[model samples]
Target: MMQAVIDRIVEGKHAVVLIGEDEVEKIVPIELISDNVNEGDWIEIKIDNDGNIISIEQDTQSTKGTKQRVKNKMELLRKRSKRNK
Candidate 1:
């Protein structure tokens, strides 16, 4: 299993995820996911030998931490944007 963060969801198509410390991005089909996931949610993904997603599950601790980090960055960006206005 590998840990990844959901970067975005493409509605009925797929989800883009960021993996590893280098933040390598991968696309996963929406149907492979077991539950609804939002951006910044951390997940554990299992892939088959052919590089197909077999399972995906949310990792609560990682998700919370990632969400907090994203929220903080967004807040900082918002403050910066307001100041530039």
Candidate 2:
């Protein structure tokens, strides 16, 4: 299983996926991604040694955690702004 994030969709045909801490990207056909997934979602991809995708699914926990982290960051930023004001 490979961990990746659905960075964005390209023209509704392919998805730009970011993998690992460095965010190395891979372009995958939209059909290969699970239907429930969307941009900014974390996903698990199973691929064979040949690099053919076997299956893909959304990583709900990772996605939720990421969203929460972003939300927290935004709240902190707003607090700092209010303090400055």
Candidate 3:
């Protein structure tokens, strides 16, 4: 299984994903994806031995936690910037 973020979706065709820390881009067919997937959503993908997508699912819990952390950090930064100004 590999973890990735949905960078973008090419309508009914495919989805562009960003993988790993370096953010390697990969294009996967939309057919292999679970329903309601959207850009910036974190996902877990299973690839078969033949290099095909066996399964893909959104990591809702992880995504929520990460988003909350980012939001908190941004708020802190905003407050600090206001104090400095």
Candidate 4:
């Protein structure tokens, strides 16, 4: 297991991850993992006995009120759309 930075998402199944000073392009089932991961984010990846990256855990900041943020974004979008009409 090592720390890596997500670079470019080539497709739904593959992405280029930068580990240390080397970038390894791996075909992983990232779709099986959580969508919380994004480009430029740091994650801990583990390769199983099959030599496949089986699990990925992102290093994220803990925050409260996620529901409030979504509501606010929706409200802002609604207001913008109304003004455009």
Summed backbone clashes in each candidate are 0, 0, 0, 0
- Candidate 2 lands at a TM-score of 0.89
Give me the candidate number with maximum TM-score: 2
Give one digit per residue, the lDDT tens place, for model 1 in 1-85.
8898888988767999887778778898887765667877889987788877778898889878867988999999999999999
Instruction: Give a tens-digit lDDT track for model 2, residues 3-81.
Output: 8899999999999998767887889999888788899999988778886778888899999999999999999999999
Off by over 4 Å in 4: 61-85
Local lDDT at 20 for model 2 = 69
The all-Cα superposition gives candidate 4 an RMSD in Å to the true structure of 7.4
lDDT value, residue 32 of candidate 4: 48
lDDT of 1: 0.83
Worst 10 residues of 3 by lDDT: 45-54
* Candidate 2 runs further than 4 Å off: none
lDDT for predicted candidate 3 compared with the true structure: 0.85
Candidate 4 residue pairs in clash (backbone atoms < 3 Å):
none
lDDT of 4 by residue, 1-85 (tens): 7666677677667666776446665555567446877666666777777767767777553112444676799999999999999
Model 3 residue runs over 4 Å out of place are none
Alpha-carbon shift of residue 4 in model 4 (angstroms): 1.1
Question: TM-scores, in order shown?
Answer: 0.69, 0.89, 0.80, 0.53
Query: Model 3 RMSD to the real structure?
Result: 1.9
